[model samples]
Target: MCVAHASGAPPSASTKAKSRPCPESPTPSSLRPMTRPAPPRSGSWTARPPCAAVLRSSATTQCKNLGPCTSGCAQGAKSSTDITYWPVALRAGVELRTRCRVREITVNADGMADGVWYYDEDGEEHHQRAEVVVLACNGVGTPRILLNSTSPEFPDSLANSSGLVGKNLMFHPVGFVQGLFEDRLDSHMGPQGCCMLSNEFYETDPERDFVRGYMMQIVRGGVWPWSTAMLGARSGTIPWGPGHHEAFARRFDHTANIGILCEDLPEEHNTVTLDPELVDSDGIPAPKITYTLSENSRAMLEHGVARAKEAMLAAGAIEVTGGGPARQAGWHLLGTARMGDDPETSVVNSWGRSHDVKNLFIVDGSIFVTSGGVNPTSTIQALALYIADTMKKNLANLFD
Candidate 1:
């Protein structure tokens, strides 16, 4: 397993592919009891009688574009850049620019946002005054924009009344373990990753020594015999060319491996700040992230390594190697402007609106209350939609 260091965030393990036989029936785990879709009526339960149970099944396992293929190994999903599906929004005349950079947000005397100041490629400054400003630049960019936008009314920084503009940063520690199996498993034919997950160790209890949960990245892929030889077998046991190919073929048939992905808790010390000395090519303050794995995160990694090794052994792996340590600067970057019920503790409300600035809203991973042991993209999208609904309904009150 190769652990690559990323800047500003930790990559999510959710993107990894899982290969398995397509089940004729829906998996029980896929059926979640959703809050029953209610009727449009504003009245109580009497106005909405429950309909028949909906079986939440996954879409057909075969790639629709590729004929009669049972394997979901083809690109998991695809979204076209053109012809966006949100037609209601397009008809509403939402203006979007391709490469506009907002340099700062201008505020009024009443502490309300008046307009946004941006610089285009020609170094020309432009302003777009609005009754409200919704900041959706996401984690790292969001904080950087806020810290850079300072006025006399907001001398310290825009919407930083709690002195927590760029703090409480967190990311995940990812590690991988690979094992050679015996048999002709044809790793390249199906999905290079796994379709099923073993969440046996997902929740960390007091009985366990770790403070956080570690997820497994099950994957199967092609590996040559020479690659295995260079990796070195268990206890320095080396095999010659033909012997190596035989062993690799045997292992590849039922080759099962797991990667470790552990969550990183928010720490005030792990922060993003403006490097006073370092400026980017744009002559703006570049974001300087000062962070390291916390004691809790380190403990989680150690616990994950142990658990992963055990799982490999249980799967009948003849050898397991390279499943340990947290790499530097992971990609799951979160926190900074965390939302909470209290204005004193958090920057945004549960609805993701600024407590101090009524007209300013932040909706992105920046407002994540906590980084759960899953990919944040789905959750972030859900939160954004939720906040957008809130804003649409309360626009009049918010602007006033």
Candidate 2:
């Protein structure tokens, strides 16, 4: 993997030498570690590599650093699949359907997935048939579709013989530590997050309270004037009325933040189920998620937050305020339909093919056996490519 600076400028000459085109086929050694340059800030930091698809190529555009990346990139340089892959797929004769919501996967008389039943924007339901069906929905949506695909042959649900369709839902439990800096850092000028990352505590140590560990990412603090005021008021740092403007000025661009991505282990109890009373506009049952941070996760968050505070203080932060197991930080959904060797213990096989329904393939986070300490997007994409290649190589025996 190549680590690029978060400044969003073209990579330096040294950085370009270390960078290479990512492999077309996934391999065990596909992500070899490469050395990174020193971070721009004062505290000790490690440059985190951007997404796997973000190779510095002539065809690719550099980031404009407009910030607010989470809200969608305005510059079209984010390299989302829609921007990077859809054009090629469209040229390859792939049909691009729009404004259609898949309701369920339909099975054939031979107990194989045939296609999907979806609803269009007009609230009209239709069935699209196929020789094989591939599901690329994320963890939640994948399991919800499978669980709702009940039939006479597979009375419980299609590819759900293991009875683990919606079980073991996992999320990246996160914590945040914001440091108040005395000087204006202009921290929000570049990519919102992904400024720098530290994996100093990523591996598990028996001495620590947690079995697994977490990653600390240096994030640019929010700098918008209105957002600053709202955050300050919510945290009681800036009160309403007389001194609000003064407090806002003090915090507008003078803060730094570190976000912790805790590795959440699989627990069968954390799950996604269909809500009995809730439904979408087409009357399809909606998915309801149930999750709680495990004791191990809470411990990891506590440790990560403490370490982040120390880093901030060492970097000359005036005040360090931190908390753990953030309620709203369940961003990466994974492990609901996990893969394994045993048919009774897993929903899919190592190749991402459903054990019970050979014609059904899953290419998403749902097939993750374990949720790692970092983001899963790159790994998910690699798995999709791997699965596609496997299907191509074994076309004759694909469903056997």
Candidate 3:
């Protein structure tokens, strides 16, 4: 994996000209050893830059690249919001509350959000009142909270007059294609995923069977010994009595993956609802997800898989194997409570303010109108910042 310097300096013009060709680009034969390339500013495709958290430098804290990034970074180098933003918020006098599970957003007699009802760590119920309420929960959680907050003023739920709060749940349906190389690539040395990105098929192509396209993310495949052995056993690649060691050796450290992130269109049938029979430890209703891939998404995924196989073969892969709509790839949750201009169509307005409850604001993925074919973290942050700025500018008439 390539590492970027912590100085945050742009590469020189000469370096830019020498950047590696994207694996899925027209010149797939030009694929070379992974090098530190300047991140693309704006383009259909480019080599993915090293994540800011993984940059190594004496001047800054960095990731040790110990590999299980999903389980929390022990080196504190993963720039999670809790490590990067919470401290600043704390310094700014933001009270950091933990171990409190919010159950519902309590509403006033006039149908305004007052605060929330929550269960503390000790399982004690508490109502924290506030003049204005904000919901930062993700697509599923936000709708669950709102749907549970029923009152006579808005008996259906808080800010749910449009009846679209838990409707239209969307997810980025991903497909995985793994290529086995002949030589060791040390592919698992750094961040587990995101070595390169290709958007060659990102836009809607009228000639294609799918309406929207997918983003191809070239990723490193980790060869954790135990996991590798388990996988090989399940796939019948490694035998139990004989040749197990030989098979494991051949399979390890020589694999790469291309992830296909398909754009999911909002569908009213794909929804989030409060489970009538299920509840958490505190007896709060749990969120029940109802989702299925649209035909367009399925077509897009099939096309993406075919293209991924072509790219792998072009890049000199000895073998490539994988398939679409990975059941466990519903990571990008969005569009449960979408934003729009009309109250009859969306739960929130353009500024993330609830259409029904003037004082209630949502700064999360739930307000997204569409699920773009990419990770939504940066966009979520940008939306939050924009909503914050809008609130600041309209403080005088914020709740009007």
> Per-residue lDDT for 195-240 in model 1, tens only?
2344445677898766757666554433344434554454243455
RMSD of 3: 6.1
Window of ten residues with lowest summed lDDT in model 3: 22-31
Count of backbone clashes, every candidate in sequence:
21, 0, 0
Tell me the TM-score of model 1: 0.70
- Name every residue pair that clashes in candidate 2: none
Off by over 4 Å in 2: 1-44, 51-59
RMSD list, candidates in order: 11.5, 6.3, 6.1
Winner by TM-score: 2
| Candidate 1, number of clashes | 21
Name the lDDT value of residue 358 in candidate 2: 93
Give lDDT tens digits, candidate 3, residues 39-112: 22224345543343422323236545555566566666655675566666888999977999999888878888
lDDT of 2 by residue, 143-229 (tens): 989888898878878788898988889999998888887777766565566456676677889999888787787776764667778
Residue 384 lDDT in model 3?
Answer: 76
